[model samples]
Target chain A: SYYEKVGFRGVEEKKSLEILLKENPLDLEKLSTFSQRFPLPSMYRIHVWKVLLGILPPHSDSHALVGGYRKEQYNDILEALHVMRYVNCSTPFTDVCLRMFQLESQVLPRCSETTGPDEENEDFLSIARSMEEIVDDPIDCYWLIKCFVHQFHAKFGDSIPHLPKSLEHYLSQEEPRLLRHLKNTDALAQLPYGLWFRRCFAGCLPESSLCRVWDKVISGSCKVLVFVALEILLSYNNVLLGISRPEGVAKLLCNIPQENTDAIVTKAIDSWHKYCGTPMHAV
Target chain B: FLEDVKCQAKAELQSSDGRYQAQRRITQLLQTELLQLYSRVETEAPAGTASGSPPGGRADSYP
Candidate 1:
């Protein structure tokens, strides 16, 4: 029933439609390159590209565009798309974002045809609409990231002997930076749901660790900010996963056992209340 | 706050040979126990389907 609501009933058809929507009439070279690099059953590259385009400056070059697409953002969009396809039991928005990304990445560089006023307006309006929808919910992005990280740790933990040294260094540095962003009340509160999760959860950490980190962050003095942030994250999770806030959080915290739930919930509430006591709340 | 906890936990986990082994066990135990309690609330929470549809009912869903 829930899956039906998110347009999961005909995933193959939907996916095919996404493929068609992503079909570009120009720049076959870039399109072919994208296809060759990401040989998956789904349009993961397209989704990542959509997020990149959405955030990238309109005038940025290909090198700048790729450079601006942070590893965290790429992983976040990838994970979000994965969850949308498999776990969340929905794929339409993911498909749309993927299409947007694909269009931006593939079409933007080579097209000589100027975007007509109506088309430009439509694109802006679509982006704004998507942003509004994503910002309205929070948990989806968190769950997407949580699931992504969990699966990654499971697949790669202590087994992948040939991991690139660059990746290792990147992980060591980037993971903390992303986590710190999530912990920042002012910063996290400002991000759209998709970007927030991409920036925070799509990295090389144990899902258990991520949840623990999130819990600790939530428990600190900025609880209201964290709670509101978590609320947004959970809302996004619910959308993607076909679960509710508590359900999504429950799943995210699945690695945590029952006895600690009370402690964690109490800590979260206390932190939120404490945060509410601030001058920021008075305004 | 997480960094602080992580630092403390990492330190605690690394303090003793036995504790290091136990850290993995404890974190797992804590996660499982806490999640069971939290799951009950998840079922009742509202679903966050995006508003509006673009023809064939493609609404963005997350989890």
Candidate 2:
């Protein structure tokens, strides 16, 4: 909790965001680049995320209009769910209807007793549970994650093709010997990249660090994510080199130091620039 | 006014598309890099650098 408070930017950072918010036509490119470089204060994150996620339009003037519509839509969806609660779950068509509603609204569908939890449902639940820890309102959390998933699903969807391989590639670039060690010992396959990439390191990294990492993801490319994962592995380079078992390597990666939020992000950014040949925001 | 909103939405979509394209391009590059490294590793004999030595059990003090 203290870490979260400390994670908030200084007065100058807050003032900078406020100034950008006041601009008549928000410069999203500048806003994105700024957000990528600095940790967004808790107060400004929602607005910045909303605009970037396109939940609120880019233009400041249209916020109220679009906000009103989105609120009405959410309320309507809520009302429908309330009515749906009274319906019989045994009806075959009800399941189909619920699925369609989830597809349309992007809201986490109320879990039914009859149906098994699918991967999509589990993913949404994981994200909702994670956001609930950080954000207060269930509604706001729902919309934020919904918009986020919609925006970056291709890059981070359930099956992110070549994610672990790409991580290995970056690792090799940094520490070829470390990568070799991991491969020789068959520890590379033990890495929880599904949790790392698909969940955006939600459970792997500390929540404060996770939020900052997500901020970069929202503002920049998913390429930054690979570097972040690489940074985590490299932090344990020496330790991993000594360990021989795959389970030991995976366990070490699962829990990492929380205080290095700034260092990890800074190093990740440097690594991104080194490999990508451009700053994350530039892409 | 409605057209302006539509245009804004289009621009946002285009920006998002650009990010996705960039992500894909980077993925392809990384794949190529991995392939090159694979070939290099194959050509060079195993260095036997990684040892199965006992760990010191230190987690926090990273180098």
Clashes of each: 46, 0
> What are the per-residue Cα lDDT tens digits for candidate 2 across A1-283?
8766754546667888888888766778878877776778888887898887767766786677666555555554444444444234453332333342363544433343355677765565555556656776544565677677666685455447677878988787789999999999999988877667777776666676677778877875777778888998888899999999999988888777677766887788777777776544431
Model 2 regions lying over 4 Å from their true place: A1-14, A86-113, A155-159, A257-262, A277-283, B1-63
- Whole-model lDDT, candidate 1? 0.35
DockQ of each: 0.03, 0.04
CAPRI level of candidate 2: incorrect
Best by lDDT: 2
| Alpha-carbon shift of residue A198 in model 1 (angstroms) | 9.6
Model 1 regions more than 4 Å off: A4-13, A16-22, A26-198, A203-228, A232-283, B1-63
lDDT of 1 at A143: 29
> Residue A219 lDDT in model 2?
79
Candidate 2 displacement at residue A246 in angstroms: 1.8
TM-score of chain A of each: 0.19, 0.79
